[model samples]
Target: MKKLLTFSKQAVLIAVPISLVISIYVNSLVTILFLLVFLPDLIKNFKKNNFSKNRKVFFVFSAFVLVYLIGIAIDILYGTANFRKSERLLPFILFPLFLLFSDALTVFEDKKTPLKIFGIFVLCFNLFLLVNLFTQTVVEYNDNSLSNKRWKKSNIKILENSKERYALFPVSEIHIADVASRPDLLMERSFKFSRDTLITRSVYVKSNDDVWLLLRQFDGNRHEGAWFHPKTARVGFVQKNITADIQKLENGWSRISVTNRVAKKANRERLQITFVDENKQYDVKGNVEYQLYVGGTQLEIGDSPSDYMPLQHRNFLEGFDRTTILNVVEGHPTYYSLFILISVLIIILFFRSGYVQFLGLVLNLVMLVLLGSKAAILTFFILLFLVLCFNFKNRDSRLKLLYVVIPLSIIAILSFSNTLNRFNQSLSSVTEKNDVVYLSTDKRIEMWKSVIDLPLLNLVLGNGNRHGYELLESSTALTLNSHNQYLEAVLCSGFIGLILLLFFVVGIFFVDFSARNNQLLILFVVLVGFNLFFENLLNRQWGIVFVAFFLSYIYKLGEVNE
Candidate 1:
């Protein structure tokens, strides 16, 4: 019977790490599997003999579960928490319960073994995500290249036709031809002398095709523009150098020079020119139009430089694989990158190879930078600096210099690039531009302010679990949750609940610190605490899973070491 129980316990413990790794890449089905795997452990805990030996640790872990239960009670009493919101908070209850009861921690003689296993899974997943990103970037680049080639071909056709029509017209005498012979050639003119002048004319092309064209006049001003069909508006083109020299040849043809400015905003494939000859005005029109024809789809030339750069650089090293990874993972890269970094750090600390630790540290920094979350990157650097400072005494000179050099090099590169500028712009956009509704930081600030100004009752007991969204929507007409977990806690369960949650987290830290001076736990708390300031960590399944699993694992490791 004891053998069977031990076998079952070992099986479930091994499954947990496997499920966690699968859950990170796969869908919620894997997450369900993760939960189900803990069931046997929960059942084992129910058997009287399976209770954890560390009663204090169990109670402290259980406190987090109690805090959420109280919030649920408050929500039920106030009728504010619904099934949907209650589902999100289920992890708060479930994870703590799982940690408190599971025999997995006791199964590992050296708890760092399981941690190392989990870290290996995380690193492997990170590599998988990186591969996915590179593949997507290559595919996207090919698509863009095809699109650009089509656009260029269509543009060249229009320029060629315009040049051909202009060459046919005489410099001494210009005559307006009938539209029946060549309806596409709208205007053509030859000049006796080159003088800067602008010629403006509106020409209408009748086609449902989305066409892009290059309009070049006889002088030398050309404009690239696009034309959308089904609109009866006249598209205009300008030639900006109709000279002022008049030459009367032996024939009854005279070349007159006139300068005019072309309208920059016009989009037309052809131009209609009206030139004044003495007292007579000659009207000439060209019907040369270029149609976009690429893979049976029409192309346009309005893609802005700002839009193109990101698309081009996304496949490159600087803006690497975030979108691709996000598409697969369905969560922000910031969170996943943090997960990877934490995993790498765990390996570095516990794996016990100086060279390996240094390599992992460098990789962590690179991954964080590539992830491109300003807060995550900043938090990582700060934590790294602290780690260096705290471990300064124990480290040899080489390791110390390596730590300093790696981070400094990454920081210097980031500073020299537009990544830092964009991060600053994002910050400035939030604080300086209050009118921008799309800025997430601005919205978070507004939500925080609104929550702070809630009625005294709500302030004391919180509005209720998941009530923050409705409350924010009501107050600000914006449907958003408290992005900050600290604010979310206070908003959901009030100051009392917030205090309980904090106590649970602080309790874990102090308990672990007292049992064993595990520096990793301190770093874990720091990472999690910093993340809470920007994200509602507990509200997210990934966040909850990450925090709960690591905290429990670290605490268990501390218990074993003690």
Candidate 2:
């Protein structure tokens, strides 16, 4: 019986972490069976008649969970309870109930084992998402400038093959929204063409007034020199290249022949083609009777666009909104990414070899940037710097260059990817814009200010996050939670709840900082605690489960390694 009980505990220990991660991934309440992690101990807690000695453990260690319980009770009494908002406190209740009922949380305190299992699986899952991000965004044609470049092959080529052969700018970036936004929109693409290649495109032009479509040749890279050819030099690069009046273009998408007589020599030369659409403004909200269209460049060597290579309405070349990598793989990429990043960072700083640590650091940092959550990225850098400083404490003064070099290289690499650089861009813009990244720092600031400007009395117990949420929707660009978790805590439970949370966090750190595995615990707290300043992660399941599970697990092991 003793041996059987021991094996059951061991089995639950391993299975618990796996369950936590998979439960969140599958995102089904049914997967919450991971709660069995604390079941054995909870039974012990309930059977303790008076709960005598366990009471102190409950107050000292359970304050973190108590914070939420108090808030929920208050909200319930006030009749302002939001079920989703109220439920964020569930993890806190479970984790500490076990801790309170039992003398020690040792049964579940195999710290590295749970984290290692969770990290390995989460890492693989993230890598799959990363690979898919790269693959999914690259849709259209490939090398040799439209890969299978050839004559329209009107005589023999298969229909599917011919469309690819003659397509130019097949990845249509020319959106109706873009056209409505900018009337005189210019689109240009470079393609290598043999002198024998004839540049023929059929355009769909729609306008109430006469529209003059123009084409020009210039290097997209240098944005200067034209297609190199002996015959074209006679003009000294002057005319509008080629212009045509497509006033006869019917209702919307009618074919208009565009012939470029510029390229004379037959040798292969890279040439850029620019299509200039006639300027016309329309209602941006799609209320306009007529919308401008400038596409269908996917024509054969002949005059018309074929049915196979119709202009793509959506352009995959621009990438899926720059940072939907997690959106593609899962629903809660932002906070969830931070969770994974926190895991990888701990593994890098303390456990892995120097090279693997550095490699994982660089790669995951890039992934964080690509994931496009400003708070997560900021939390990453701050924690990384702290870890570096901690590790570098013993190094000689001569090694300080690493301190500067490491961070700068990361920033430099991340800077190159514009999609996720909202944090970087907000530094310069006087008026913040959400061009690529979803949220801007200024927008977050604006959201924070809404909470600050509230009456002092109302803020004391906050009208609840539902009220705060209404404030976000009314005051800002979008409806979002309090971007600051501290604020979120206060909003949900009032300052008392916030105070309880902070005190518990500080208390846990003091207790755990003495463990031989304290390096891991310290870094983990730093990651999650710091991120709370920027995001309301506790409201979400990924954050709720991960933080509660690991913190309790570590709490059980705290100082025991000593």
Candidate 3:
């Protein structure tokens, strides 16, 4: 029975990554279930020698779990039960199981073989991931330009493989209301227009295009509704029967000029210019139409458009309303990053090579710099500078270089930034001109504030595995997860859960520095801590898996003996 159990463990150890890879294509739910089923055994492994061998580490771990659980209780009390609530429940039982199994394994068997095998698995997996990412990037870039004006094969492939059918840029952007109160035509109400109705009259105007006539027309009803979709819009002409005598010049950027010869005695039918586009079909309103024609062309055309803009023809169009972030695996790429960090630590622990140790440190720092956490990105330069001032070696030369480079970098970025801002605002102006209201501001602030209010008690006992968004929503302005990690910890567990988390963080740093298992652990820890500031740190599969995998690595590193 023991032999069979051992064999099962080894099999799982090998099969987990394979399963994860397949899950990228098959089903994320199944992969997640498989991990959940195996979690208890995984946690049990952490309970080595009854945790008596490392009392401090065990206490830290225990406190963390306890706080997390308490948070779960709070959430339950608060009526935040939802799908995430079930997820929050998972770590409670599964985490302890991981500790238990880990403890048992540590006490009974040699760690070297298993740890080495796991390291090999991580290395191979990382190689595959790197190769895939590199190839994909190459192919993607070759097929598409950096300007984003062209499509890539990968994108096309994704579209082809998708279960749904869709069109890119199928809609026209310009929408004008048909009705107006008076002849001035400057105050017409704007309404939503269908994409299908927009393209027939939309055109791209070059920088050299005559702007005098068009700019005045643009002022009348440029954007009247919520401008959410960001697409380009310019001037174009639509042919009408009354203007059939005029040549139909339909070159995309042609200067459309109209000449009308209606006699003064011709009964008072208004002369007007009309544009029919793929997104909408509508007639131009009022004197606003005359203002749109060039100087000489204005005289060549007929009488001015009437002031009575009708309110009858309004189209109520809405932008694409919902979006879902697709997951290739049960989690995201970052989830696997923690496992990679662990593998490096394991190699340093068993190999005992200074070269490997240095390599680990470099890789760890790079990863944290890239994906550690949002907090880390914001504060890394400051922290690095502080370290250089204190404990970091080769400080003098680097400090001088950094001092010069930092100021120069800031100045260069600022100088070039105006160009970037103009480019962005140009698009924003064209797209959002129609929007009367938007929801970007209040929602972000609300979620952030809610995260800050998590209580200490909730930090120990985890709230649960899943209910992060539900628990934090009340305190937030938007329907979002607690972007702060400490709050996420309290929301998921309780004070006890937080303690376990603190233990997890502290353990990684201590092991990183004391055991010298892999110096990279410090960077990884920093990254995770930083990420906690802006994102719900552990509600998603990627977050959970990454945290677990990294902690396991830290433990392995700490256990390495001199």
Best by TM-score: 1
Score candidate 3 by lDDT: 0.39
The per-residue C-alpha lDDT of model 1 at residue 444 equals 75
Worst-scoring 10-residue span by lDDT in model 3:
317-326
Which tens-of-lDDT digit does each residue in 97-174 have in candidate 2? 654455333544554555566556666666777777666445332222222321111111122332221124322222
lDDT per residue for candidate 1 within 1-562, as digits (tens), equals 8776666555555555455445544424444554576678678767866554555665665565655666677777877756664455555555556666665666656656667776777766666766766675555533422232212221122322221111123111112223222212222221212132233222222222322222323321243222222122222242333322223332222222222343321112223222211112122133433232111111112212121111122224432323345555456776776676577567656766666666566556555565666667767666767677667787454446446655564675465343454365466656484553444466677888888888878878776665655777898887777777777777777888788778766676565447437778778877888877878777666777677767776766665566
Off by over 4 Å in 3: 1-8, 14-65, 83-134, 142-446, 450-476, 489-531, 549-562
Candidate lDDT scores, in order, read: 0.52, 0.50, 0.39
Return the candidate ranking by TM-score, descending.
1, 2, 3
Candidate 1 vs. true structure, TM-score:
0.64
Query: Model 1: runs farther than 4 Å from truth?
Result: 1-55, 62-71, 88-90, 93-102, 106-109, 145-321, 396-402, 409-418, 430-433, 510-516
lDDT of 3 at 548: 49
- lDDT measured at residue 546 in model 2 versus the true structure, 0 to 100: 69
- TM-score for candidate 3: 0.45
In candidate 2, position 195 carries an lDDT of 46
TM-score of 2: 0.61
lDDT of 1: 0.52
User: For model 3, what is the alpha-carbon lDDT of residue 378?
Assistant: 40
TM-score to native of every candidate shown:
0.64, 0.61, 0.45
